[model samples]
Target: NKRVNHKRVYRLMKQLKLKAIIRRKTKRYKPFTPEVTAQNILNRSFNETKKNKKWLTDVTEFKLKNGNKVYLSAIYDLGSKTILSYELSSSNNNQLVFNTLDKAVKKVKNTKGIIFHSDRGFQYTSRSFKAKLKEHKMIQSMSRVGCCIDNGPMESVWGMMKSEIYKGNKNFSFINYELALIELAKYIHFYNTNRITLKMAKSIA
Candidate 1:
């Protein structure tokens, strides 16, 4: 048996153009038509002194093995940088966002004064979702049109999650939609329990 350096093997693979093939997921959701647009109350202030005072929500899509997409809607607490609740669905509809919000409200002790921020996506701007916020007596905030940086923290969560769990991982291409959901659930648990951050020096859990 002969030994070959891993670097040389990688170089050879690169030279042979034998890199992995990963399909880029495209955004297929309908264009957002704002029924109601809230002001940028969050104002790029990604910090909250008290828990449940400020929260962020967003949806990110994942492509499964069967060429179908699944959306993950999550609510993140700015104070603790914790994911309060999340819902996975095959459709990125208003119900998905509303269900995620419902879950978060149930888990939290107080929701009357929480300022929930999100992009001006159709799901967030829908009249029904606005009514849901009002029903909880929560304040709604929207990121400025076409400016994602206004909701930078929530975007960071999606970026970090995909990089760690889905990107460059060949296993995802073979996993069925149901298993992908399960895997995402497990990853969310690990993220809240084991992942450490410099801001808190502790897991978000």
Candidate 2:
């Protein structure tokens, strides 16, 4: 009956201290296993005195006003405190990570035995990415399960970058995807050549 709606029933139940029991449905999908995994060779030892000795990489996302998201995969050199290379994509798949690594490696002559550390992201743990690292002769170092500190430096850099770009704002959605990309590219250049360097110089001076 129209008189026996949900609101009236709920109110009557509340008055009588009555409650309904509900059972949650079980998930039907199985757990996914990555094709490859590596040891945490970096082991939270984030310090490095020589350039290219250690590099950390990760992906972060930016949401646009149009409800679309862009992915940025970046590599940060620990010793130089510089971003070696970064790639932006509409998809956060293996290609984004691969392109960033390839771009960075092309600029360097010797990548032999360099400690390339990252979290156990599916893209990083994929077979193809492992093969790419093997081809470059770079060492693979992954953060141990449940250990975010193992990839702390890269996380911290991401924080600093967002803080400066967003001006302490949260969820700062960009108006246009292309313009957002341009802003990101400009910020990276400034961070490497001018902005963050100036801050570091000032702190040292």
Candidate 3:
């Protein structure tokens, strides 16, 4: 293992014009088609007093060992910076977003005028989803096109989740779908009940 020192190896590689290659995983499916675009009502105002006053939702994709993908749809409470609900599925379809929305609505106490924020993904823009929001009397807010900063809070949640649970985990890629599900479930529980954030100065739960 000590055949070559790290500094010497770096110098040799530089001399040979060699560099480490980082392979990125590519999406297996086509990107979602946009149906409707909503204004960024959130406007990066991530603070809220009431727990259910403002919520954010988004879907993230993860690759499995067999080249298949899994999608996680989550609802985050802006007030507490807590995960209200989440759904994992093999497909990132309209149903995935619907299910997650339904779960979060049920878990929360009230939602008469809650502002539900998200990016303009196809699932969120679909007529069915808009109807669902109207049915619950929830206001739908979306990030402006090509403006990731509008959904910064939700994006931060996903980033921290991945960093804590998957990144640097050597065997993560070798795990099967079911195991991946279990791992995520456990982490979500810990995140909601135990993990602390400086903003809250306490655990979200």
Candidate 4:
């Protein structure tokens, strides 16, 4: 239909422009003011002292409405600001967290002395989790009980996923969760390759 009527395309574009102009002139939409504040941890210390010296992991739970919940655990490589691995499951347990960690470890060539940082959540403090880190020759690190800055990057990613992609949607099934995961993968690809980071200004040249 668009191909058959070239003038129709121009008319639609004009209508869209008029609508946009009217909306802007009328001030119908208000700017968003963020109520929740995230601390700036990476101020000038964003660079990792060594590769894999600090890795961040975070867990976010989404309710499935029938009272079931899906837990998502992710491991992020702080050095590269990249998501190394993530796992989604109906249960928030050691198994899910371990699977995420193992998948991340598999991607790295050397696992020795990697610092895995997370909140003092039970999943991260469990004996099973500690044992796995020891087995992989990685060190365990934890943030203070109430500090979000300690794991800011991971939390930021989760916030973006929840607000931008899954806003107003709740009680998702496995299939819906899979679709969100695929969308997140696409967003992450755009973030890493197409979106320029302010920190990379000097390096880009």
Candidate 5:
């Protein structure tokens, strides 16, 4: 009855020597500590005069037709509006971020003091990533909690790229993880080479 309170029902059940079975989840909760954190040094400043001075990065996912997903982590040069490097994996982990950063770093020299901005993801906040930033002499910056717009440019890039990829081929599907990775790679190449050139040409026209 609506008037019956939970406590009274529990007391009655206990008096009657009855027990209700409850289901509990099999998984246990795990806690982790972030190895590093930093201030919002970028602070919504999306512009930079030089190519390597400011870099933005984030991870996004692609859903495949078979209900699997692929994680893609990428670094974009804020000044150049260019995709410096990217890595796709089935798992979203620190290694994905590491590989993308490594690829971007391998292509550039003299990376001292460049501001690298990202959301406060565990991968970015890890001790290993902090050490990598130190090794490269780059500055680490993180967005405040629950503030996606703190890294607006990076978020916008992921949105734009995902839209363009699907818009270009409505019928096509990333049927599997490997195929998703391949398609993402192709789209990024086009984004860097063809799409950017066309946008620049349009601006000039």
Candidate 6:
């Protein structure tokens, strides 16, 4: 039998020296409709020939004042791995995505064929958001249905920000939101210029 028969494995005796534990539950969701028409444009990886060639966008939510939620959407340049544009909104609506995309496009003009990759969240899939992408002459790409790892970079970013910035906050207030945004901006600056990315082999945006 490929089993460890150590008594400690089943022992519940030591409450005095117990280790802190975390339990996680899995949730399931219906799959998004596949968008095969869109090119596997990001090539299922993060590489681009030029600085503004490809962009990845994602949305994350945070608990805000009085149980309301604040959503953060951002576009990241695939080449430099820097955040191109980001915005915070009370809801993760299509308007939030459109505004972030508009800001990113304005910030980096000449993105005629850049790819914008994101999960098939409702906001990203909405008519307005797609229209904005089309208006900017941007290509749209979505992570495959039910595959979160396809957007691993953004997931890691969220985890890091939550652990470092929002882990201890018991309640969210307007001032807290302001402070969190400022802190996130600072983190972005440091992450882009100063922080070393092992995957990139050096410090870079």
Candidate 2 per-residue C-alpha lDDT over 35-151 given as tens digits, one digit per residue, 9 for 90 to 100: 899999998887686889999999998889989999999999998889999999989899999999999999899999999999988899999999999999999999998788889
Q: For candidate 4, write residues 20-61 as lDDT tens digits.
A: 334335535343342222222333244674567678888887
lDDT of 3 at 44: 89
Q: What's the CA RMSD for each of the models? A: 7.2, 6.9, 5.7, 12.0, 10.0, 5.5
Model 5 / residue 48 / CA error / Å:
1.9
Each candidate's lDDT (Cα)?
Answer: 0.87, 0.90, 0.86, 0.70, 0.88, 0.74
Candidate 2 at 77: error in angstroms? Answer: 0.4
The window of 10 residues in a row where model 1 has the poorest summed lDDT is 196-205
Q: RMSD to the native, candidate 1?
A: 7.2
- Model 6 misses residue 104 by how many Å? 0.3
Candidate 6 lDDT trough over 10 residues, lowest sum = 32-41
Off by over 4 Å in 1: 1-32, 167-174, 202-205
Worst 10 residues of 2 by lDDT: 23-32
Model 4 deviation from the true structure expressed as Cα RMSD, one decimal place = 12.0
Residues 132-202 of candidate 3 have per-residue lDDT tens digits of 99999998899988788899989999899888877778556526779878988999999988886785574
Q: Residue 170 deviation, candidate 5, in Å?
A: 10
Worst 10 residues of 4 by lDDT: 35-44
TM-score of each: 0.81, 0.82, 0.83, 0.65, 0.79, 0.75
Steric overlap count per candidate? 0, 0, 0, 0, 0, 1
**Candidate scoring better on TM-score of 1 and 4:** 1
TM-score of 2: 0.82
Enumerate residue pairs that collide in model 3.
none
Q: For residue 162, give model 4's deviation from the true position in Å.
A: 2.7
Per-residue C-alpha lDDT of model 6 across residues 114-160, encoded as one tens digit per residue: 77888878777767677778887888888876677777767777777
Q: On a 0 to 100 scale, what is the lDDT of residue 135 in model 4? A: 93
